[model samples]
Target chain A: FFQISPAPSYANPGIMQETISVNDVKDAHKNWCNALLAISKAHSEGGLAKSKPLASEIIDAAYAYQFGPVAFKPTWAYGKKTFRTTKDGALSYFIGDNPKFNDPGFGIGSPGNKDYPNLKNRSPWVKCTPENFAIQIFGNTAIGMGWVHFEAADGYKSKVDKTLSYIRDDEGNLRITVHHSSTPYSW
Target chain B: FFQISPAPSYANPGIMQETISVNDVKDAHKNWCNALLAISKAHSEGGLAKSKPLASEIIDAAYAYQFGPVAFKPTWAYGKKTFRTTKDGALSYFIGDNPKFNDPGFGIGSPGNKDYPNLKNRSPWVKCTPENFAIQIFGNTAIGMGWVHFEAADGYKSKVDKTLSYIRDDEGNLRITVHHSSTPYSW
Candidate 1:
């Protein structure tokens, strides 16, 4: 027996239905990449104080956290921290410095220095590019999957497989409901 | 620089626009649950010979592997097997017994015996229930996130947090493009 009752229809008859186009999805990806770059730049210039607020704003603008908990499986998060459903968890994943999660701050990165000699040398990301292999649009919602290549200021390049599910909000803004990223499997 | 060129729209102007209701998403979930139960039953009644074909059919009918690589992250998979994009990988995840992937066969559990002395005792699942916490329907596409509970014949109960992103196919069938499952974080 199903324990969940079907939710009420989110559609409003009074509002005109606007179909989401492929360009819209691309634009959304661009916005996301730009936000990540901005956060990294902020962190490099003024540390967490500058980056944390920007990361928060980006999360608020990009994700569907307002509706409820988002399904966020970050690239490096593992074990108990694999899924980040809460806004605070999302923030910590982006900018880190949160003692509770012990995250390396994927966006900000950590430098290899005396304090953390074992940690990998990762500088703030300076370049971000999305290479979508498949994009399926279903009216107001869309799903895109492909590889996202990231480059840190130290010239280190990393790539991860990424999938993002988007739903158009009442104001025609596309918000991410599911974001899953993982490194490619190697034999 | 974005490396992806925007894909052409999939909408057909001649066809009448059909909005996907919340019930449709629930129905899709029900179909998925039923398929899992059927696979388990098949394995119990006739072993891998009987269950393998059924698993293959279910994978084809349910997943969007036709569109391209699906972003699938199974619950128990780890290391190089974490993400299953290829159809072969998906099949291996469901039925196991494939030496290439070295899967424990999540759907068809291993019994406590000499061959698998260290393996946990797990019987074929007999019941499946989905409790969706959030379902966001955007016309032809939908995303659902919740917990799915499964019960094996031995009365062992397992629950996993799941997220599924579905897009309505040309034939009016809901096909999953992104399926992510993980155990709830225990901190």
Candidate 2:
């Protein structure tokens, strides 16, 4: 009756892969943004330490995972309020004891203030929606982008152009390999 | 005697895949940046026409590719000086016949002055080097980041944080999937 369980559909692998990849990106993106909001909430309640492990879970080990080899260089290191140059430094700034925001250097510094690394402050990000979300899926790898709208706790509203690239680990989880965010430009 | 050529060495596919992906991204990035300089040169010598084809080749077809389906939304809209919101609008600003430099709006208008959209004016980019280049290779897809320094033909110099995400097509060609560039924030 069962003839070798139907060969697993390796035929049309490209099309199948694209479908899976797109869906994966969509799901991962939702989780990723939600995680940001969750971290903010946790920070507001208990402080940045509460969000450290959550942050680690979302980011790729290559970028910085305490349990993994530390190859420090975050994709989110841009703008005046940027993350630390090294993953450890960034983690420290976020959850550890360090208060040197706005370091004056090109590719080096903690552009974020010395307060809580909670992005939305005590205010929660009600909506982290993408204006023109675009995704490019390549097998188990993908990149996604769009102008992210962050509706903060208050009536405060802001948006940043966000881009992220990631790969699925062995366990089929999307780990953010690159993250870059910045406000739109104007003179 | 051949013995199936030792099974074609599929034993360490992960390691092999990483090496190939990293190399591919490096080559693509080099070509991509150099293309910017080349386009600038062409714009200076001829005009936007000279650079149009080059631009089309590097960018994802979704933005503007005559031979492919016209899917608006480019992977390379970054910073304050951006193109129009729509693809046709952006194409109009880029190689189109119109020239509306700065229209007042939050997410509308090209902050770039009416010129040959080659970025650095008539000045050739002598150097577009990265301060700290970081790359995360994910099979056929990848993302790269660094603070790029631009030295223009007029001796004007500036730096912008740049990030890009891309995937290799079936033909093994790299197409930029996302590009975001911004100046460092300051208070």
Candidate 3:
């Protein structure tokens, strides 16, 4: 037997009609970690030729670029290139080799040079672990802040303070609208 | 004549049932700027005892502390005190004078010493202007990135790179879920 009810009318328009939960935010973080590892693996196995498409796909699926400009601030980005709002800028930051932007390919890694001494011995990343210190959920949106640890194949380890805001997309998938990463500040 | 319609059901559950607009994000930024100026004015006229309650009210109205921890990284905050996730921490950053945290009362300004040379001659802020570079809208959530310039009563000026994420709350008010601010990175 089916009981039919009146069309649902929200009494409080300010309240989220479809709520996002804390578990949902955690799942989004897990998905992002897996995607990063995948990009690194693709880079190591096939180079930019192989990793570019995968990275593009991941960016399209994870970021809200189609919706509008994404607020992305990479850890090492400085000067005018600090904020990467366009999709192409995001691509350069993830895959590298773009002459326009002075990116060391943060996700893929670049050859060691005088300018990038730290990247010289680095290989593709082998691991990524997200330790979320705080998570806030509001309706279809959520924000997470914490530290993300990375281990390179060459055993080089690094960590960054990361803040991300996720929103549910048209297809019910969570997508990142804001991403800010930086090394922990010290005296 | 009365017409009866069936209950409204979302065909795409993943899509936002209620969408936020670009204008909404801009309005939120304006509200934030006004609140900052109000806090400064309150401090200039009365001091922390008078400004603290006003700051508290503004924080409660503008931020999503009621939802959960906010991902707030204030400019000039260093070491372990960088992120202010709790309402109390947020209050301290805005009104200052907390012994627990090493805040110089960023919003209210403190008497400067050898440790804070730059703050020595600084006075309460008299003006705040937001220049948004990018804005992204997703359903009931939006993210904005831009520069916020401040001018002190004594003619001192400063600016910071700011990124804020807003979500419509239970009362239909736009509230900040993520707030990250820092001095622009240079070579």
- Candidate that would win on DockQ: 3
Model 2: runs farther than 4 Å from truth? A1-19, A48-86, A89-96, A99-124, B1-24, B53-124, B169-172
TM-score of chain B of 1: 0.86
Model 3 alpha-carbon drift over 4 Å, by segment: A1-20, A44-46, A110-123, A153-157, A169-172, B1-20, B109-119, B153-156, B169-172
**Residue B93 error, candidate 1, Å:** 3.7
Residue A174 shift from truth in candidate 2, angstroms: 1.5
Taking the candidates in order, what DockQ does each have? 0.10, 0.23, 0.29
TM-score quality measure for candidate 1: 0.65
- List model 1 lDDT by residue over A38-121, tens digit each: 999999899989999999999998998997778787776766666787888899999887888887787885333414313565
Candidate 3 TM-score versus the reference: 0.77
Which CAPRI level is candidate 3? acceptable
True contacts kept of each: 0.09, 0.22, 0.38
How far residue A186's Cα lies from its native spot in candidate 1, in Å, is: 8.9
lDDT of 2 at B157: 70
Error of 1 at B43 (Å): 2.0
| TM-score of the second chain in candidate 3 | 0.85
Across A1-187, the per-residue lDDT of candidate 3 in tens digits comes to 1223456569623332466678878888888888888988998899889999999999999998887778888776766787888889998888877888867777784233425523555488778898887887766777888878888787778777788888787567888888888766442
lDDT of each: 0.76, 0.50, 0.77
Give the better candidate number (1 or 3) by DockQ: 3
